[model samples]
Target: MAEEEVKLHGAWGSPFSKRVEFALKLKGIHYHYIEEEVLTKNKSPELLKYNPVHKKIPVLLHKGRPIAESQVILEYIDETWKGYPILPQEPYERATARFWARFIDEKCWPSVWSSFSEGKKEEAIENLKLLEKELEGKKFFGGEKIGFVDIVANFIAYWVPLIEEATGKQLLGEEFPALCRWKDEYVSSAVIKEHLPSRDKLVAHFRARFPSN
Candidate 1:
């Protein structure tokens, strides 16, 4: 491959992987897409070499260098590409954006991911409401546009709902109308919708993974 080439190693059903795609598309960068069979634990040698520690997908190979971790790769994409920006411009704003993204990955998403367990739903809703409150007076965590935090929270907008359906859990509901509205707005956008995994495929993936649900 040429030194200037860009390649993305990812799985189709992964929200982490797709967030990187969202950034690349927004930046109008053309990249080769390499699918890794992550679900079956059949990681490729290339993916292993690129992300040896994680042994996972969503590794971005740009200019002959490997960048792992979706969040890290996102910042790299924004900095390396010229058109669209995933992170904010101002120093304080950029820090705040990173903070919220970290909160989603560390706090909110974890709470919801385990909410199916007994007595965990309340904790999950509490964390979700924290995010809902953050969305106040803004269309997205990125304000009027989609930014780093919004991309980080893509799992909540798409995957979490499917998890609720597959697990028969009530994490998202009428209690948070603002979040519901934001979810629809985010997922319905032409840029995001164009690349989102089909609902049928996601539902089937969820069902197959959690058959007991």
Candidate 2:
């Protein structure tokens, strides 16, 4: 493929946006990144046109077409660039990887985020425990090498510790030793370490967003 213009429309604090950004960086793809302010009602006209249904941020505009959903965008980047393959090449392995990725994106993410609210502690802990069990004794969700599922699972790990600190409730502890080690490895990776959001900023943002909780 010849040199093409790629653009990402995203918000700073959004994990969805960060996923795409990490993929792009890992693949050594040079693209323009437009950070959107999603807190307010206003959204960029480009974003509006790209994702008409969801009207959400983290839209990846490749050439002229736009792709929403972080996981979809990550696949697009890997397939298009062929630089750093995020998804496994084998058919069954690719399917397995995608399965876990979707699980993290759909189930684990919602449960983890729900912990921030009042009256959701029990449910959140149960959900987190399930994840811990699934991840027990695993270096990465995809084994040794960091793959698509690992990336998606660890998207919120950076915030989870701080959330625990803020709320004084530790969801990940000795009970999930492997998971804790995995979290450390995931965060320490160059791609994630460089691009992760500021901890102080995230704490302040969440504190303001959920003041009572």
Candidate 3:
């Protein structure tokens, strides 16, 4: 297979960007990583050009063709690389995976953030319960291996704990034992650990972002 020039434009603190990085690494694909400073108005011209619509971080350029949106990028990577399948082969299972991924990205993320910032912890816990049921007996969302839903829910494994610490509240508890167990496994997995930001760094970042008590 001929190697294509691949590049990813993203920021360090973005879970969405990390999902793409994790996908690429899982597929054993090498690519250049370009860090974009969205806060400082330092988004590169290439990033702006590639993702004019969103003008957001996490733009994957494959042979100079840009793929915007982390979920879309994950699908693209799985399709392009035949090895290390990210989505299941069965149609029903594939649809289920995509559905859960969308649920996490759309509904769960907002609820989780609202709980952290607005003090609506109950709402976040409800959302987490749904995931816990989905993960009932599975080692991962993708059964044995980390898959689409797991990648999309990466925020739960890393960022949510920091949010809990910063808010001085425990949003997740013994009620959701399965989800808690999954989080530990997901964060400590060798591939995921390599891509995750250090716990200290993440704690500091959250503290800086949400300093008020």
Which residue pairs in candidate 3 collide? Answer: none
- TM for every model, in the order presented, reads 0.94, 0.91, 0.96
The lDDT per prediction is 0.87, 0.80, 0.89
What candidate 2 gets wrong by more than 4 Å, as runs, is 1-4
Between 2 and 3, whose TM-score is larger? Answer: 3
Using TM-score as the measure, the top candidate is 3
TM-score of 3: 0.96
RMSD of 3: 1.4
lDDT of 1 by residue, 1-213 (tens): 342599999999999999999998888888999999998898899999988898987999987799999999999999988778789999999999999899888888778777764447777888888988988888888788888998999998988888777777667898788788888888987889999988888988778877776
| Candidate 1, run of 10 with poorest lDDT | 113-122
lDDT per residue for candidate 2 within 94-168, as digits (tens), equals 998888787777777777777666546666666667667767878877777677877677655677887776666
Error of 2 at 173 (Å): 2.1
